[model samples]
Target: MKEKKSAKTYKPLQILAIGAHPDDVELCCAGTLARCIQRGDKVTIALACRGDSASMDLPGDKISSIRSREALHAARVLGAELIEMGMSDYGVDLTLQAKQVFSDVIRQTAPDVIFTHYHTDYGSDHNNTFVLVRDAALAATVGNFRTSRPAVSKSPLIYMWEPLAGYGFQPEIYVDITETFSRKVKMLNCHRSQREWFRRRGGVDFLDYIEVVAKFRGYQSGVRFAEGFIPLKNWANIGARSVLP
Candidate 1:
């Protein structure tokens, strides 16, 4: 098989994928992260919380710790760094404090591109994740945002990932993940507890459902496997071609 081209053609970019919970990024954009890693780009996985509420049957703290470990393991699988924002599970709110924390992460990382949840998602955390990232992405570029860290040199290109299956998500970009799909699945499998939680609580095969979604997205993009995103277009996004898939 031919080796994939390193992402060296474009300037090395810091890419951040933020989600409401540990498994959210894995379920949505792990394939894209894996591809970025293959191409030698820097990748960071940020979760709004430790996903403690993912399984209420277990103690919250215990599940939070377990989920954090799982998130770290998944990050390793994709050669990315994991950043936990320490919000309580099912408790993500669109508050000033939350915005500050989210802004701090963006400024500290100085990412060139950000992928986050779609604001129209069913879950509150998912919807709030979108709001927080959108606001923080803007605040991170302003000198007077009053965040913990210094402002980023410029705002990054922000893109929102596909929402839950039934949500009204219309994708404007599609990343072909044909070569990285297996690794994406492997990374998602690191959340072993989530799989068990889904079965016991939701009665769903987690991996199976995600793979099906990936396949469906791939079909939309004319690829064997793919991930879809909608660009959060604005003045900052003009002429930013390096971040596009």
Candidate 2:
């Protein structure tokens, strides 16, 4: 007898995962994004900040460039296109301006699925990224709002990725990523600046946080490792029908 394979609903996804920091997307949706790509989805990542906050000695502008490069490298490793909203570090507010940027990204990427920080987070950037991504995912279609980017599809599926949760985080949808766990680690390792920064907290070993989170979620879903996501909207159209025949 032969082992069976899981269903490969390889939908072509115009997917976007937004983050407040360069490493946020790697920590949150990199595994899921890898899985989507493996199954033939087109994925994109938008960083709200270049993660200049990780350093104090360096000039913000200088660190910002380094972080953006690091984010591009990480996204490339995960096989996703990368964009930076260039919102000021720690300056991400639920302002119309932020929404305008979100509107632009959504208009361009035309995401079929949008991922971002959970509603409950410990940082202003994280919270605000969620507000803008969620709002823009739905609002990108309205020309009246007037984003410079050409309008794309309306009402894409939106999900919230991990919240870093030490403040008591929870997830609604858990994706089994046991097979893709190593790939997730690979994605994290691509963010060199972050890897170096976390080393101070406890180098290389500290990187296991992503794996630990995935393993915990995988257990919930009966897999060895996984990433969890909570939909911004209560329900989404999830089925083979959404996949191309």
Candidate 3:
């Protein structure tokens, strides 16, 4: 009998994972990000919003402040740096301001790969972020595109993390994440403020749901735990490297 072929492994020099809110990155792709960091890849975590409007009990600015701190802790746990784009939580849009913010992030990070929300996410902010990041990723590579910073010589490979709603997302690939699953949960626990929000919604244990999703995706791909992703299409020959195994 023939032995099974090994999955492709990638050690990208740098990776940036962007989320619509403070905890979105942890909820979606923290395992993958954690794995990247373990392999000595420099990882940068970016959020389109400070998650200011996520809670009504706290004022917008206060919520933003709290979430920013929480995000920093989470990033530290994952061995990644954090960048908060300072957009409103639910008001993220595909405006010029958003485009420029995302472009600036791409230029500043200069990551070999970027992971962000899927275009078809159920949340308005998530979908809008997808639009801006997609545009900005392209804009960051254009020499004539006047951004605050200089353009990068090349655009990084972009991957869509699984959507928050999970209903409409069609994952095309899976990365086995058995080794980093616990660390991913620990990283997510850093977002202390969001616990009540999830607790009130479906009475679901947030961490358990995340683990279950990873396990389900892993089962689909013959692994013990995993994170799924769908590559952005229509880009010729870019994003061909596999960062997940």
Candidate of highest lDDT: 1
lDDT of 2 by residue, 19-136 (tens): 8988888887777888888888898998888676786467888888888887888888888899887777798988888888988988988877788888779888999888887778
TM-score for each candidate, following the candidate numbering: 0.93, 0.87, 0.91
For all candidates, the clash counts are: 0, 1, 0
Regions more than 4 Å wrong, model 3? 1-11
Better of 1 and 3 by lDDT: 1
lDDT of 1 by residue, 153-239 (tens): 878888888886837887878999999999988998999999999898878887888789888988999999888988887776434
TM-score winner between candidates 1 and 2 = 1
The lDDT-based order of candidates, best leading, equals 1, 3, 2
Candidate 1 global CA lDDT score = 0.87
For 62-148, candidate 3 gives per-residue lDDT tens digits of: 888988998999899988999988878687987887788899999999877888888888888998888887888888888888778
Model 3, TM vs. native: 0.91
Lowest summed lDDT over 10 consecutive residues: which window, candidate 1? 236-245
lDDT of 1 at 87: 92
Candidate structures ordered by TM-score, highest first: 1, 3, 2
Residue 176 alpha-carbon offset, candidate 2, angstroms: 1.5
Better of 1 and 2 by lDDT: 1
